[model samples]
Target chain A: AQSVTQLDSHVSVSEGTPVLLRCNYSSSYSPSLFWYVQHPNKGLQLLLKYTSAATLVKGINGFEAEFKKSETSFHLTKPSAHMSDAAEYFCVVIRSPGKLTFGTGTRLTIIP
Target chain B: EAGVAQSPRYKIIEKRQSVAFWCNPISGHATLYWYQQILGQGPKLLIQFQNNGVVDDSQLPKDRFSAERLKGVDSTLKIQPAKLEDSAVYLCASSSGLPGLATNEKLFFGSGTQLSVL
Candidate 1:
């Protein structure tokens, strides 16, 4: 069985400040990890993915996540926050090829 | 290059009533999926189809929920005798390439249908 847990349900940050959304996973095998973002009334958009290649992965909109196998963590981060960065973030773990187990999600708020 | 398309952006129904949602995948995409997202929760996979064939539906509520992709291009999901818990966003997603090969492939999603059961 594979599952994902997001540490925070909601996070608020001021503009130009660093942002971090923590996530952890449980999987029997080496899993593929992904980060997705969803805006209000919009569909989910892929931020980045980790497929056992590089531990540190960079994504769109200046976002990135580091895959830590020892700690069973894949935490999303950004050096600076923007108003448009406010959205719901999901951490996904895929043990099998197409089956994805998603976390509860973290709602990020940007304060200008 | 068009993303997944879904219909009935919003729907409202009484308990025990039936409702249906539609989806059209990207051109030549072989896989389609249906997910339910409750408030403050991530989307949960309800069903998956690979070119008109059922690939996985372990999580679907078989008694009250059903789905199909007849021509392998478009799909539909139906819920009967809707419950209060069924009030959520039904998202339709599609991916290209072979089934069970999604590590490299990406799933494109629609805006989703927000269903409200009264």
Candidate 2:
């Protein structure tokens, strides 16, 4: 079974500061990974995905993530933090077609 | 295109009571999923349907939870004799029904129904 672990329960950063949310995955085979963000009272939106393509993947809202097989990590990053970026982020791995195993989640708070 | 639509944005019920949530996925989507998101946790897949057929329900508590996706479009999740542990935001998502390995199928999610079991 494929699973993911989010390193931080919560992360705080000042506006204009860089943001990093760490995630590590375990899968027997080369698997697909994803990062999804959920804002307050909103739906979860896809941030980025690594589908065995490029090692570096870019997503919406200036967010990006790097897939490192050697490290078994797909950490999300951004050059700067915005107040609106405050949300709960989830690192996900697909155990199968309909099964999407998710990490506990990491809450990101931007300090203005 | 319109996003996934869910009804009764907020629901509150006493323990052991029955509750149901409705969801309308994006048009033309063939795969629908229901997820339970407990506070401070990521969404957990409860059930998945591929065009009105059950694809996965291993994590679903069949004793109290039930879900259906009739006609391969809309879906409803029902919980009878609910427990306090069942309190969570129920999210409905849909995809194009691509192969399972296609992780980038791009799931469209609903705003979710927040269920509070008192």
Candidate 3:
């Protein structure tokens, strides 16, 4: 089954520094992948998605993910981290007809 | 536009009790889903409904779990004889198009209902 693995369970970055959340995927074929973020007491919001379009996908809030098939990875990156970026982020991959498998999640912390 | 709506932001019940969670998807959405997120883990799908019909419930524990979308707009998930392990956040989501079947489709989510089963 298609699934994604978030290499880091928690990532901490100083404010204004670059942010990188690593994610590796396992699938026999090219798959649809997504990045979702959840804030405290809020819904999970879509960050971005890769649907076999351009290898590089830009999403809301200055976030982007590059689909690297050769490396089987779709890592989320931001040029500069902000305090508001602290939250739990999930990596999702569509497996079956209605199945979207989610990784354990990566909690991002922004240090002042 | 209004996002998915879920009721009772929090619930606390003893094990073996029965509890139900309600959800109202965005107007005009055809697909609704229920997911359970345990602390420190990602959300897991419980059931899915497409226009008042069951699309998927493979992961739902049918023994004590049940869900329904009667009018195809609002949904309810019930857990009878809740277990200690049932403590988690119940999330409701809706999409205008088929979710996993369509690669580009997106889902609107609710804040979720936190259930604490003692």
Candidate 4:
């Protein structure tokens, strides 16, 4: 069985500040991890993915996540936050082909 | 390229009523997926299709939910006698190929249909 846990339900940060959204996973195999963002009234958009190639994966909009096998974590981070980044973030774990197990999600609120 | 397309961006129906949502995958993509997203929750995979063949439907509730992809390009998901718990967003996504070998193929998503059960 595979599962993902997003540590925070909601995170608030002011624009230009550093942003972090924590996630941890449990997978039997070498897992594929992803970060997706969903804006208000919009569908999900892929941010980035880690497939065991590079431990440090860079994604769109200056967002990135590092795969730490020892910690079982793939936490999303950005050097500086922007108001447009405000959205619901989902941490996803895929243990097999075409089967994705998603975390509950963390709502990011950007304060101006 | 045109992205995944879905129909009926919003719908409201009474309990026990039936509703259907449509999806068109990206051009030449072989895999399609349907996911259910409740308020404040992540999207849950309900079904997966590889072209016209079913890849996985283990999480789909056959008693009230059914889906099909015709011609291996377009798909539809139907919910019969919907329950209050069925009120949520139905998202459709398509990928180019299997993972690992095609790990870079990110899922292209549709706008999704928001279903509201009264």
Candidate 5:
């Protein structure tokens, strides 16, 4: 079985500040991890994915995440927060083929 | 490329009523999935289809929920005798059902249908 846990339910940061959203996953085998973002009334958009290659993964929109095997963590990060970054973020774990499990999303709020 | 498309962006019905949602995946996507997302929770997979064939439906509430993807391009999910718990977002996603692909094959999701049970 595979599962994911997000460290925060909501994260607030001011514009231009660095952003961090924590996520941890557990899987029996080598798992595929992903980060997705969803804005209000919009569908989920893929941010990035980690599949057993390159500990450091870079994604779109100035975002990145590090896959740590020992810690079993895949925390998403961004150098600077933008107002447009305000949205709900989800951490996902792919246990098997076509079986993708998602963690409880973290709602990101950008403060002016 | 165009993204996944879903219809009836919002629907409202009373308990015990029936409702249906439609979805059209991107061109040539061989896999389609339906998920139920409750408030404050992650999306749960209800069913999956691979080119008009049922792939997995273990998590679907068979008693009241049913889905189908005919011709392998468009799909529909139907709920009968809806319960209060069924009031949530119904999300549809699609991806290329290829073999031995691990990471780059991303799943494209639609803007989900918001179902409200009164």
Candidate 6:
């Protein structure tokens, strides 16, 4: 069985400050991890993915995530926060082909 | 490259009523998925299809929830005799190949149909 746990339900950060959203996973096999972002009334868009290739994965909009096998963690981060970054973030784990188990999402709020 | 397309962006029905949602994946996408997302929660996979064949539907409520992708290009999910708990956003996603086979392939999602059961 494979599952992901997002550590925070909601996170608030000031503009120009750094941002971090934590996630942990449990997978029996080598797992593929992904971070997706969803704005209000919009569908999910892929931010980044890790497939046993690179531990530090960079994504669109200056967002990135690091895959830590030892820690069972894949935490998403950004160098600085922007107003447009406010959205719901989901951490997903896929152990088998075409099967994805998603975490309970983290809501990010950007403060001006 | 057009994104996945879904219909009935919003729907409202009474409990025990039936509803259906449709999806059209991006061109050349061979895999499709249906997910249920409740308020404040992540999207949960209800079913998956490869072309016109069913791949995984272990989590779908078979008694009342059914889906089909007749031509493998478009799909439909139907919920008969809906329950109050079924009120949520239904998202349709598609990928070019079997997901894990390629590391760079990602699921493209539609805006989703929001179902509200009264």
Off by over 4 Å in 2: B99-101
TM-score of each: 0.97, 0.97, 0.97, 0.96, 0.97, 0.96
How much native contact recovery, as a fraction, does model 6 achieve? Answer: 0.61
Chain A TM-score of prediction number 4: 0.97
Which window of ten consecutive residues has the lowest lDDT sum in model 1 chain A? A93-102
Tens-place lDDT digits, model 1, residues B8-104: 9999999999999999988998889999999989999999898999988999999999999999899999999899999999999888858546575
- Candidate 6: where are CA atoms >4 Å away? none
Give candidate 4 regions above 4 Å deviation: B98-104
Error of 1 at A107 (Å): 0.2
- Share of reference contacts found in each model: 0.50, 0.70, 0.64, 0.54, 0.55, 0.61
TM-score (chain B only), all candidates: 0.96, 0.96, 0.96, 0.95, 0.95, 0.96
Residues A11-87 of candidate 3 have per-residue lDDT tens digits of 99999999999999999999989999999999999999999979999999999999999999999999999999999
Clashes of each: 0, 0, 0, 0, 0, 0
- Deviation of model 3 at A4, angstroms: 0.6
* Candidate 3 wrongly placed segments (more than 4 Å): B98-101
lDDT of each: 0.92, 0.92, 0.93, 0.92, 0.93, 0.93
Residues A1-112 of candidate 5 have per-residue lDDT tens digits of 8899999999999999999999998877777899999999999999999988798999999999999989999999999999999999999998666678999999999999
Interface RMSD of 1: 1.7
Q: What is candidate 2's TM-score against the reference? A: 0.97
Those runs of model 5 whose alpha carbons end farther than 4 Å from true positions after fitting are: none
lDDT, candidate 2, equals 0.92
Candidate 6 residues A82-103, lDDT tens each? 9999999999987577677889
DockQ of each: 0.62, 0.68, 0.62, 0.57, 0.65, 0.61
Residue B45, candidate 1: Cα error in Å is 0.7
| Model 4: per-residue Cα lDDT over A62-90, one tens digit each | 99999999999999999999999999999
Candidate 5: residue A75 lDDT (0-100)? 99
Clashing pairs for predicted structure model 6, backbone only: none
lDDT of 6 at B20: 100
